[model samples]
Structure formats: structure tokens, C-alpha cells
Target chain A: MRHSGYQIWLLTLSLAAATLGAIVYATGMGHIAVPASEIIRVIAARVTSNPALLAGIDPVFPFVVFDVRLPRILTSTLVGGGLAMSGVIYQGILLNPLADPYTLGVSSGAAFGAALALLANLTMMGHFSVPLFAFGGAALTLLVVLYLSSFNGQISANTLILSGVIVGAILAAGISFLKYLADEQVAVIIFWLMGSFASRTWLDVTVVAMAVVFGLGLSFFYARDLNILSLGSRSADTLGVESGRVRWILLLGASLVTAVCVSVSGIIGFIGLIVPHLMRFLVGPDNRKLLPVSILAGALLLLVADTVTRAVLPVEVPIGVLTALIGGPFFCVIFRKRQRRVA
Target chain B: MSATSGFGLSGVSFDYGTTPALVDLDLCLPPGKFYGIVGPNGCGKTTFLDMLTGSKSPDRGSVTFMDRPVAEYRRRDLARLVALVPQDFGIDFAYTVQEVVLMGRHPYIGRFASPGAEDWRQVDAAMAAIGISHFKDRFVNELSGGEKQRVVVARALAQQTQFLLFDEATSSLDVQYTMQIFNVARNLVRGEGRTVIAVIHNLNLAAAYCDEIIFMQAGKVVACGPSDSVLESSMIKKVFGVESRVEVDDFSKTKQISFRYWS
Candidate 1:
């Protein structure tokens, strides 16, 4: 059946809003015994009932709900959206369905840079120095990969994937070297690698929000280019798309956002690789529609995953463990479905 | 037939690594003409077409359109005049026919502006002109090979370019679909004054449809001019190493070449 463009946008907006609300509510219910009413009460008191009611309430309840859970939930929404949008751009630009932020080696480079910053005392100078270093590292690594792949004149998908694999290995080696230098600092590196959202504050929220907003804004700006690139590079160029320019811009943009997210929350995996693919299955691959919807879906999935990681057991499970546990089977199911379709 | 020349290549040559692809290639295409290029594998037929559409730059000499070097033109400005139809059409998305056609209007769109009503009307007209309007809402990826070829041609037409290059565009199509595609190309040239340069492997089909033929051998133009001059039995044997019989059927008044042996 034919669907008007307006109808699709409207439907997407509703879905995103509904998912946003659900993430907020569910994350509020995690890591504590707060009922839904109490969660709402804590939020309402902070917003509407002013400082008087806030003063009378148990400081711990308000602190857990408003201070702790709220920032963590907001950070997850922004990071998830950023990662998914990055996946969409990478897949479209590279013209490969398997392309994602990590596949391009952005995450490994960021991990190396974060490790370097921690071991080198770079963050001792400024609060946001580590995240800044990570962002710069990701952008630089992507630029190098893009340059190397385009060396023979045309940037083929295979070339990008091959370069990404090579560069990722190199960055992983660098991270290991850093890990070995400071034996006691191994705990910090391991925690970062396993991925967590354990200690988020409003300051972390602000930095992540800034990066995600910039990333999504750039995604929308190049949404049309992404759609054209999906038609294949030759067709894209024939249709007046400067393929190289679009590719460089998108890779750097996505890498920057992903680096910031990883730097702040550690190396949360699977959301970038899975959320965009799931959104593509549901809504097809028009970047105009796929991008915004994926953003919402990613946030929703990550938030739910984050809540489960916290609430499923007395001890908090690392976010990476939960995502890996869910992502492997989920990817297998998608692969089997794809195989059936191809057959 | 028309006053304007769609493309002109002069003193052009190219090489891939150490092997020469095109050596001092020269060709001129007038507007509203159907030019078919035929050659064996690795004969540089596709390379010639790519140079004309600005996909690959010539190593020496120049390609010009309307007296301007092709490279000097802005990307969108070049697209406004010429469109290329590559042989392979693989898309990961499930965009409907209308949506794919609308993509051809990318050059006309402004930043953040959606396609206006007239733009969609043009998309509909292009689809209707190609007789695929019935599949407007059907997913493009689900179409048969022939249908996909037609849809892609329709997209090129929607670009509103004056010249189109078809790089072995019909290799994957069936017999009936191949002729249908040729008929569409014929209409675009005859009715709309659009110039078309197509790389075709089927000599008989080219004989029946093309106004001019250029035959390449090992990256050089061995023969070019009228279709009758280029499709001679001797040239076919020399370029393709196939013993072939050439005959002109009286009913169709077309030269047909049929290959019989490798020698």
C-alpha cells in the first residue's frame, strides 16, 4: 500500500516519543525499590512542588531518582542515539550493511586514546581532557583509514573493511601496550573495556548530550547524501554526489560522537551494530526516515538493557556483558533470516 | 540530426597499470543519436563511456561537452547534462519505485527542502513514460531483472539529462526485455532529441537499433561510423576471433551477424 511521506514521519515521531517515555519510566524503576508512583512523585516534587517538598522528602530517595537515575537514563538515550546514527551513516557511506562504528575501528582507536590519557595523567589538567583526546583519536584514525582505502583512487567497500580490520588490530595492540605499562592501572583499563554506566553525573550527561546533538545534527544535514550513497558510489557520483567529500565528513562526524560516548560511559558494545539494523528491518533504509527512528529505537533498547543489567541481580552486571549476551543470538537470528531470504 | 554535440573526445588515452586501455581515442556524438559500442571482453568499451561521463579522467587529451572540458563542470552541473546507467543495480534498501525515481531529482532539491509537487509529477511522468507506473508502490529490489533495468532507465530519464550512457545495461535482461529497453532508448533519441551512447554485446541487436556503431579492439577504435561499416564479418572475426556470417535480411533491412566457431 502507498504511504504518504507525512504519514511515515508522523508515525515515526509517535514511536520515538513513546519509546522515550518508556525509557525514562523504566530506568527510574531500576537499581532501587522505587514504585512507579514514587518515581513520578520524586520527579514532580523536583519540578513542580519546588524546594519546600523536596526538603521534606528522604534525601536518599530523591538522590537516587532525580540525581542518579535521571542523568544515567539521559546519558544512555543520547549515547544510544548517537551510536545508532553513526551506524546508519557508516553503512550508507560504505555501502555495506555490515558497516558500523566499531567495524570502522573507531571504538578501538578511542579505547587506545582513553587508555593513554588515563596512564599519562592528561586528565589531571582538565576535567574533559580524556574525552577530548578520545574524540581526537577516533577522528584521526578514521581519517587515516579513509586516506589509506582511497589510495588506489577509488574507495571500494572491501578496501574500507580491510583497512578497518588492519587499523583496529593496530589500535588494539596500542591499547595492550598501554595496559602493560601500568600494572595496577589494569583495573581501570579492564573496567573501561567491559563497559559500564555506573558513575554518571550531570556533567557527564552534558558532555555526552553535546556530542550526540552534534552528531545527529550532522546526520540530518547529510541524510540526502546518505540516501544517494546507498544507490552505490558510481550512481551517487553520476547523480552529482561528491562521493569522497560525503564519505570523509560522515566518517569523521560519526567517529567523533562515538568516541565521546565511549569515553564517558566506557566501551558499550552491540547498540551501534544492532539498533540500526533492527530499524532498517522495520522501516527500510531511507536515511531520512531510518536515522531518526533508529535513534529512538537505540535509546529504548539500551535503556532497557541498562535497567536489566542493574536490576536482574543484586550485583550490577556490566552493560557490555548484557548486550553481548543478547546481541549474539539476536545477530544470529537476523543472519538466518537474511539467509532464508537470499535462498 | 541536431545542431549540438552531446560529447566529443579528442586525443584521449588511458592505461590501467602497465596495459593501455585507450590509446588516443577520438569520438564525437551528436545530439539525438543512438550510438552503440560493441567489443569483446577487455576491449575498453566501458572505459570509453566512463571517460565521457566524467567517471574516469583521461590520461592524455580531453573530453568536452558544449566546448567545455568535462572535468571543469561542477558535479551537479555535469549531472544536469549527462547521466550514466551502470550494468549492476544492487540496493540494500527496499525503496518503492516512486521513491527511487524521486532520488533522480536530488540535484533540484535545496537543503532541508522536500520534493515539491511538480518534482513528484515529473517522477510519475518518467515512470509512466517507461510503462512502469503500475509498480510505483512495489519495492524496486523485488523487481525482475528486466523490470529493474527499466526502473533504472526511468530514473536516469527523471534526471532530465540531455545525454545518457548505458554501460552494458541490458546484459542481464531476457530477449523480450532487451528489445523493450532498445525501444525505450529509440524513443528517447527519436522523440525527445536525447543522445544515448550504449555499450552493447549483442551485435544483431545493435545492428537493428543503433544509428551509429563504434567497434573497439584491445582499447583502440578498430572501426567506427555507420552500423553497416562497423559490423563487417572481417572486423568481427579480427576483433572477437570468431568466424561469423553477416547477412542483411530484406524484410527488416538490418545487418545480422551470427557467430559459428572460435577460429
Candidate 2:
């Protein structure tokens, strides 16, 4: 349903408030029974630098909230938002709502890069090598997919999807070959591919944060062009958008967002696709509004998903596995719906 | 308006690989006129529109707007000068009609800026001019073909350009909608002094609305003049390979045609 401005603003405000609540609740989770009240008190004390609020709090509680949980939860939220933001760009540029980083093969490219780094034990950039390589792989894949799909200057949706499928298939084979070469270290590769946020450090948060921020800056900068682009390339160009240049910039920026998120958290899938779908229903198709709401909604969805795996669930499931579990069925529903529309 | 006030094409040619779509075509389109490009299928009518609208540049010559090469104009600047109503108006995403029309303001608004009050005023005026203000809040994807076509026209109207190109914009419509669209284009030209160009398949509609007509055959213009003169029986037989009779409808004071397959 199309919402009026009042309704949209109300929904955005509520989502923002809900995200804050989720963060507090999520931080109090895992083995420790620290209530949300304690989470708030500890955070307040730390921020104000006053001993009065922390007078009676357990010393371990501050470390738990500030050190252990904050980084991981913050990282998950930012990564989730970043992925969803990228999804909006992909869907807008490709003019197909089903298009996402995963569907476009960007995530697989990042996965392949990380796997290659793992196999080679390439520590050239030390701990930074994996993400650097992942970024390289994703950037390279984007160029190849664009080149393969483009004819003259126009990139058709069908050609792009087909090229992505072919490139992704070949990359999947390359990843498997790397796994075989990994031999003893294949287990590590397998685990990373599954995706997780456990034991995430500030460095992980910092890197993903920087990439996502830069990405968001680009998204906001080109949000108007993206809105025009949804009308298709020829129309968009006539409507005053440099469709080719905008598509390349936005696609590369979004792919870089995906690359960083995947490098940090592995191939977490559906948050990108599902969050935008949900937000579109709430906010309609204008990217300027859809984008900000999608970012918040995506962060909340991923944070809740991670929380369930981290604390509420009896068995720890990989974040990637859980998103795919939910996202796969969701994808089928969307696919079936689109098929019905066509039929 | 000076010599540069309208569109000019000289030595224009385009090809799909070895097959030429437009060949060595030179034409002048004046301001404040309603012009129609007419030809049979694959006769470079659409290709000519594509070249004029800058969707495709001429391979061998220059297309100028106001005496300046269209290629030299920035995309946004060109968009401000000319707006196109494409043949297909179907969009996959659901944006409200108001939102779709508001996109015309893109050329005037900065990348970081939102549509301010003046922009909305133009949008409302355009929608009002097209008589679609009742469905302003409705999703564009849900509109009927005629209504959507009107919405697309409203978008171009909202662009507030000096020129409008209709690339078979009414080809999918019924006879009623086609007449309605032409009436709107004619009104724009007569009332607002806009340069309106349409690539039309229906000779009757073109004859009824267009002040001037260009007839193309085999990637070249065979005849061009006032519609009554340009769309005669001889031109019809030679260009479209059809036998036709042209008449000036007394009541409407416009050219009309009756056609049969060539014997």
C-alpha cells in the first residue's frame, strides 16, 4: 500500500526506536542474564564518565556491554543495513526487484576472494589481506559481468542476469578448486562461507563501517539518478540521468559495500533482498525514501536474526544459513508471484 | 527566435551493422509547429526520432538543437530542451502518478536537492493540463493504457521543454486514445508554441493533427510538406505501397485518408 508522508515518517520513527530497543536487548543476551536496564545503566555510565551510575553494577557487566557485545552487534547492524542499501541500488539499476548482491554474483565473488586468501595464507596485508582480496575479487567480477552483459552502451537486464549466472558458476567452480587445494584448511574456508558474527572485533566493525559509510554517501548522492533510472535506461537518459555512468558508479559502490560486508561477515544472503522488499511495501518505490527506511529495517532484521542465533536459539546456527533459510523461501514466493504476473 | 531556435539535421545517417536505418537525411524542424514523421515499418521513422532525441547519435552527421550539436549539450541540459514520450510506458516498480510526473523536475533540481514548491507547482499544472489530476495519488502501474499514456504525456509536459518527441507514443492505443493524444499534442503546439514531433503509424491521426508531415521510404524522405500536400495518393502508393484517397474533412477542417492494399 502507498503511504502518505505522515504514515511514512511515523513508520520510520518507530523503526528507529525499535532498532534502539533491539540493540539494548541484544546486548544483554548470551550466557549473562544482564537485564536491559543494566545494559542501559552501564552504557549511560560509560558515556557520562560518572561513577554514580556504575556504583552498584557488576564490574564484569561493563566489559560485557562495552567490549564484547557492542562491537559484534554494531557490526551486524551496520553490515545488515549496508547489504540492504546495496540491494536497493542493484534492484534499481537492474530494474528488477529480484536483483541483489547475491543474485548478481557479487557475494560469491567476495566469497571466492576470501577463500583464495585463506588457501594461499596470504598475509601480505596481514589481517587486512582477506578483505582487500575480497574487494578485488568483487570489483573484478563487477567489471566482467558489466562487460559481458553490455552491448554498445546499454546493459539489458536479461544479459546481466545471464552473465552473472555464468560468471557465478565459474567462480563457484574456482572456489571449489581452491578448497581442494586448501586440503587441511578447507574446514576454515567452509566455516567462513557459512558466515558468522561471533568474536567480531572493533577492527572488523571499523573496516565495514568505513566502507558502508562511503557507500551510503554515494547512495544519497545518486539517489535521484537511481529513481529516474527505474524507468529504464533510454528513458532515464532522456530524463537527464547519465544512465551508463550512474549505473557503473552505483553498481560498483554497492558491490564494494557487499564485498566489505561479505569479507567481514561471510556470505550472509537474504537481509539484502528481504529488507528492501519489506521496506518497499512500507515506503513505496521512491529510492530516496525507500533507501533510508530500508537501511534501518535491514539493520533491525539482521540484528534480530543474529540475536536469535547468538542467544535465544538452543543451537548456534550460522547467520548465513539462517538468512538463506528464510530468504530462500521468500525468494521462491517472490519468484512464483512474478511468474504468476507474467502468466 | 533566431535560426538556432529549432532543430536541424544535416547529412544524417545511421546503420544497424551493414543495414542502413537512416541514410543521408537532411531536415529542418521549425519552432511552434506540430510535425509528424510517417513511414511504413522499418522505414527509419523510429530511428529518426531516436536520433533527434539523442538516444542515438547520427553515425555520419550532426543533429542540432537551436543550432548547437545535441551531443555538446549536457544530458540534463538536453533533457531540459527536449522530452520524449516513448512507445512503451510500462514500469516494473510502483510509483504514484504524482511521483512519476515529478521526475520531470530532475533536470531543474540539483542532485542533492529535493523538489521544492515551484517544482510541485509545475507538476500539478502539467497533470491538470493533461486532465489526470483525479488519479494523482494512484500507482502508475495500475493505470489503464490510455491513462498511463496520458500520464507519460503529463510527465513530458511537466518537463516543460521547448520540444516534445513522441516515439510511436500512441501506437498501442485504440482509435479514441490516439485521437485524444494527437489533440493534446496539437493543443500544445497551438496554445503554448511548443515544437511537437511525433512518429506516428496512423496516417489519419497524423493528417488530422500534424501541421506538417515527413514521409520516409527505404531510409530516405520521399516527401515532406503540409499534411494535405505531403500525404496525397501518389505519395501513399509510392512510399507505403498502398492505394489511398486523401480528403479534407469539411467539419474538422483537417486532412483524412481512406486506404486499400495496393493492387
Candidate 3:
């Protein structure tokens, strides 16, 4: 069904407001529980450049809100948004409902890069080295997959998916080998692989935020063309959509978003897969409407997951483990329902 | 047909890897008439339509629409002048029928702009013309095959191009809708002076609606002319390897062919 522009705008606005509310609420729930008012006050002060707003709060409150909670919260939110946006693009470009950001093997590539960095103990770039390497690995993997899939300047969905699976398997094996090489440090490597937002800093947040914003803008700009692309390449060509050019641009753009997100947060799965499907259920399949709503929903989902793991759980489970535990069952439900409907 | 005024192909050839789809050939199709291409499977009928729409460029020679090389026109410009209804449209997404039809305006709509009121009006008119206005709000995937084919036809109509190519577009529709759609195409050709080229599977239907007929066999045009001249029994036997009785239908005043197996 077609959603009116007003309805989509209203839905997007509500989602944006809810994400902000969740961020503020989540920021206040940690060990040293600051009130929501103080969280808002600290954020307000930071935004307004006014020290006067910090008068009555405990000195530790500002430090915890800014240095401890907010960075991790924002990073998880942006990463979630980025992954979800990527999922929408990947699914649309591939024209497969089952496709996700990881369908391109971007996460496996990023994981392989991070594992290599950890095994080698490279610290030349300090906290940025691993993420930088991971991004590089993802970029290279995307190039390889694109190269393998393209035949006479045309890339079919089946070939692209096949190439991704083959490349991803190779990378998965390479990561396993890196784990074997880590020996005593395998626990650290494993922990990173499990994924977390435990110690994310402002730098991580900024990187993800930039990538998500740019990616969202580009995706939205091409959302109409993406919708036409679902009609298949020949129809899209007849409708004047440069199917080859637009498909690859969207593939590269979405892979870039996935790369940055996975590099920052390790292998966070299912958000990219689930968020688009969930939002499509709500907003219909028009990518123009789906892109913004999916991004916000993704950000909200990841932030809530991070908050639950960080505060509500008795012990801190890795965020990735928590998401997979929840999302795997959730995905099965969606898949089963779709199968029943088709039957 | 005047070569300078209509779609003209000279020494055109295209191949699928090592296999030839369209051999080196020359053909000219004039505007403002319905032309039907009939051939057995894998006879390059669909490939010919692809060439006219510029979806596939010929490996040799030139294809021109209105005396301009089809390759020289921008993709959008070509789309503005020509539209196609493919045989198989495999869309599994849940876009409403109106939304699908509205996508025909993509070539005219700006990259960042939304579909204007004019675009919606064209969509509504096209849907109405194709008798699918009632199901405008229905999800395309939920519709029956015939309904979905109507929606696709409506989309091409909404494109409002002078040249329309149908690649076995009515294969899924029932006889009633198929005849209705052909009547609509005939009206587009007669009243609006548009050009239509349909790769038809049914010989009688093509003979009834098409102003001209082109028969292809083994990647070559075996016959091309009016239905009375080109659509004879021998040509049908030669192309399809079947014996047929060609008779003039008293009701429709058109040639009708009935096929028979070799005894």
C-alpha cells in the first residue's frame, strides 16, 4: 500500500524522537545512575557551550555522562543506523528479501582485518589502527567481489551473492588461522569478535556518525531509482535508470557503511537484516520511505540492545551475542511467517 | 517504409557469446502502425525488440530511430521516446499498483523530485485505460498473473511514449484481457498515431490487430509485409515446421490460421 508523504514524515519524526528519548534514558541508567534531567542538562550544556548549566550536578556526573556513557551510546546508535541503512540498500540492489549488509561478506572481511591486527599487535596508529585495517579489508573484499561478479559489465544478483559467499568463506578461514596464531591472546581476539560497545570513545562515534549521515543522504537521494531497480535490470533500463551504474554505486555505498560499522563495533549481526524487514512491514517497500525509517529503527534497536547488556543484565554479555540470541529467533519467526504466507 | 523516417536497422548483428541471436540483417519499420513479430522460440524476436529499445546494442552495423543512432540518444531521451513491456516481470515486492504504474514517469521526473500531480494524473489515466483502476491500491504481488500483467501494461501506457514494444506481453492474460489490451494498442496506433511492435505468440490475434507482420526464422527475417502477403500457410509451415490452414475470418475481416500436426 502507498503511504502518503505526510504519514511517512510523521513516522520518521516519531522514530527520531524515540531514538533521542532512548539515548537520554540509556545514558542515565549505568552504575553511577545520573538522572535523565542531569543527562539532558549535561548534553544541553555541551551543546550550548555554557558552563553555568553544570553548577549543581556531581562533578563525576558530567565526566561519566560525557566520557563514559554518551560516547558508547552514540557509537552504538550510529553503528546500528549505518548497518540498517546498508541493509536496505543491499536488499534492494540484490532484489533479494534475504540479503543483508553482510551478504557481501563485508563483516567477515572486517573481522579478518581486525584479527590480523590483534595477532600482529600493531599499535602504530594507537586505537585507530585496527579499525583502519578493518575498513581497508572490507574495501578490498568489496572490490574483489565486484570484480568476480561482473561479466561483460553486467552484474547479476545470483553471481554477486555467490561471489560474496565464496569470498566470505575464504576470509572466515583466514580469521580462524589468525585466531590459531594468537595463542595466549586468543581470548582478546575472541572478545573482539563477539563484539562490544564497552569502551567506545568519541572518535568512534564521530567516525560512525559521519559515515551514517553521508550514507543515509546518498541512499535517500537514490531511493526512487532503487525502487525502479526492483523491476529488474531490463525494465529499469527501459525506464532510463542506469541499472549497472546505479547498482554498483549503491553496492559500494552500502558496503562502505557496513565496513565502517563493523570496523567500529566488530561483527554485530542481524540489525542490518532485521531492521529493514521490520520497517518494510510498517512502511511498505518504497525505499524512499523505508530508508529513513529503517535507519532510525536500527539506531533505536542497537542502542536499546547495548543499554540492556550494559545496565539491565546482571553481567555484561557482549552486545553482539545478545543481539544474535534475540535476533536469530526473531528472524526465524519472520522467515517462517513469510514461508507460510507464500505457501 | 521510408528508412529515414522510422526505425531502421542496417547490417545489424548480435550474439549471445558464440551463439548468434540476430544475424547481419536490414529492416525498416515505419511509425503510426502496429507491427507484429512472430517466430518460434529462440528466433531473435525478443532480441530485435531489445535493439529498438537500446537495451542491447548490436555488435555490428547501426540501429537508428527517426534517423538518429539509438546509441547517440541519452538513456532518458530514448526512454522518453520508446517504452517496453517485457514478457516476464518478476517483482516480488509489495508495491501498490499505482506506485508501480507511476514509475513510468521516472525518465521525466528529476532525480531529487517527487512525482508531481501531472505524473499521478497520467498514472490514473493509464490505469483507467487498461481497466485496472479498481485495483490501484492492491499489492502487485497479491494480484493474479493476469492482473499483474495488466499493471505492467498500464505502466508502459503511463510512459506515454510514441513507440511501444511488447515482448510477449499478453502471454499470461486470458483471451478477454488479451483482446482488450490489443484493442487498446490498436486505438493507441489509430487514434493517437503511436507506433507499436509486439512479439506475439498467437498468430490469429496478431493477424487481427497488427497492421503489418514480420516472420523470423533461424535469426533471419523470413517474411515482412502486410498480413495478407507475409502470413500465408507456407510461411507458417516454413518458420514453425507445422502445416496450417490460413483463412479470412468473416467476423473480424482478418486472416486466421489453424494449425495441424503432420500426419
Q: List, residue by residue over A57-149, the lDDT tens digit for candidate 1.
A: 566888898787888877877787888888888888877666677767787778777778878989564868888788888887887887788
Can you write out model 2's per-residue Cα lDDT over A1-343, one digit (the tens) per residue?
7688899999888989999999998998999878888899998998899879987888899999988999999999999999999999999888877888887788999899988887888998987898888888998988888789988666666577778779989998998898888888888777778899988998999999998899999999999899999887788888999887898899889988998899889899878789899889878998888988999999999999999999999998999999999998998898788767756
Which stretches of model 2 miss by more than 4 angstroms?
A37-56, A125-128, A143-163
- The parts of candidate 3 lying over 4 Å away from their true place are A1-5, A117-136, A139-167, A338-343, B1-3
Taking the tens digit of each residue's C-alpha lDDT, what string does model 3 give over A86-150? Answer: 88988887776756757677888878887787678889998767777777788788889878988
* Alpha carbon deviation, residue A31, candidate 2 (Å): 1.4
Which DockQ values do the candidates obtain, in the order shown? 0.66, 0.74, 0.75
In order, the TM-score of chain B in each prediction is: 0.92, 0.94, 0.97
Instruction: Using lDDT, rank the candidates from best to worst.
Output: 3, 2, 1
Alpha-carbon shift of residue A333 in model 2 (angstroms): 0.8
DockQ of 1: 0.66
> lDDT per residue, candidate 3, B1-263, as tens digits?
25357799999999989989999879999898899999999999988998998889999989999989998988889888899999987776889999999999999999888789999999999999999999898898898888989999999999989999999999999999999899999999999989999999999999899889999987888789998788899888889989999999898788998888657
Interface RMSD of each: 1.2, 1.0, 0.8
DockQ of 2: 0.74
